[model samples]
Target: MLIDTYGRVATDLRVSLTDRCNLRCTYCMPEEGLSWLAKPDLLTDEEIVRLVRVAVTALGVTEVRFTGGEPLLRPGLVGIVQECAALEPRPQLSLTTNGIGLGRTAAALKEAGLDRVNVSLDTLRPEVFKTLTRRDRHQDVLAGLAAAHEAGLTPVKVNSVLMPGHNADEAPDLLAWAVAHDYELRFIEQMPLDAQHGWKREGMITAGDILASLRTRFTLTEEAGERGSAPAERWLVDGGPHRVGVIGSVTRPFCAACDRTRLTADGQIRTCLFASEETDLRAALRSGAPDEELARIWRQAMWGKKAGSGLDDPSFLQPQRPMSAIGG
Candidate 1:
């Protein structure tokens, strides 16, 4: 197993298939669509599969998640999922999508061996959705969730960014909806990663506040289980199969247990989501480098991983690259 300097195991890998997205989420991208990575720089499906093999076989990676500006935008996503599922000691394969195009691809994705999905839905109101995502396709996202459920993608998760003035009031409603549908709902506190938009601390809705508000409506029982590297704290409502999770990355950073690393669409390996530094793997792959050499490069990159990110640092300085480019 490749343990970083922080003693964090490299167990989870989130690979971005593309930097292109269909929606312009206010928290992710700028109003004027941001410039995308050059097509030539993005890793091919073959390269992605090869890296996954190295991550699992050589680095002890047990879980692999496909992310992107929108992973479904990648033409060969199904093929990638198939290859990942076919690994010798097959890792748990999952995906994070905006759900704009999942309506038509859900069944195909499940057949291709995708184990689960997390759909981004910030609001249930159509106008609020349009204002948040700059796209009037809330109905499509809802349809995508139903389609995913129909396709046998068990435990479908809905991820909502709880922005203070934006979708804060809809928290209980979202949780109630998730409980009714038996879908795992996660309300994430907004981070300062979107520096391009001049994010302020006041704009954030703390996890404490959310839980306090939720406790008034639902009897939340603390979940006694092995938690993942994610910052989300899990809670089981009174009588529901679906659990509610609050990802307090901003107010409560789980940096010590951060076992996941990200690979950008252009093949740069990021040790942390809030990291500004990255190691480029595309250059090595394009130069006809051997697998051993590639692995060595990855090792070097992992070895240099920092103990914790600067998200909570008083001197925290946001990187020029937006959250989309970082594969958040």
Candidate 2:
């Protein structure tokens, strides 16, 4: 069950298909970009599928989310989704993408057995989007979101990171846009995950700020229920089924309920986003380790999961790898 010493079982797995992305969001990477992994270092389609099979069939993972610097950039993505869907007790499949190329691929991915998608879109204004992403693809993202919806990716989620002095003022407008389009909106507090290592607690927006900004335009009622292992704190928008979510990874860490284990594009297992070390599965896979051995290694890796992200600790150091390399 991949149960940790803390008694938290990891039933959700995040797999990074590639560390490559099309848009260079300022919060994620420098405009010039960081050095990307070489092609050989990334797990092949077969390797990725095998690991996912083991996670579901052996380790009991019920949810598998494919993430990337931009998952849409992975050429074999549709095929990968198809293979993962064929697993016995088939896990719910989803993808996290920047949404640039999604406009063209959403339908194909949905047909390939992808259950849904979460697209990153920070601002409604094209100029703000351009400044934040260092790319002129705002329209592309909107089109992509529409395509995902058209593809019947129900409850399409939009992930927004509020950067102070940038698109912070657009919270209400973003929510309004999301609601109008039937896209579930989630505002995530920026963490120290950028490749540039420039994030500061004071500079990033908080969950409080997002709610306050939202209240100015709409009434939000705290949705009645335990949040479970989901990171987002959901609020019923305008008092109904429509809602907005805030993932305060910095201010309101939900590590206590975390049920996710991450697999890097290179096959390293990361138990926490801020983890200083990674467990090497690539080496084991390449060296002809059997399935049981692979599952044992994974179980051992997750058993050492940290109690919390330690962002509050005075000595906390940002992880060496950026969000792009680690997968969101």
Model 2 spans > 4 angstroms off: none
Tens digits of per-residue lDDT for model 1 on 115-220? 9999999888999999998888999999999999899887899999877677888888888898888789998888776636577776578899899888878989
User: What lDDT, from 0 to 1, does candidate 2 have?
Assistant: 0.93
My TM-score estimates for the predictions, one after another, are 0.97, 0.99
Quote the positional error of residue 312 for candidate 1 in Å.
1.8
lDDT (tens digit, per residue) of candidate 2 on 181-282: 999999999989999999887657889988999999999999998899999999999997899999998889999999999999999999998999899999
Clashing pairs in 2: none
* Per-model lDDT: 0.86, 0.93
Per-residue lDDT value at 247 in model 1: 88
Worst 10 residues of 1 by lDDT: 194-203
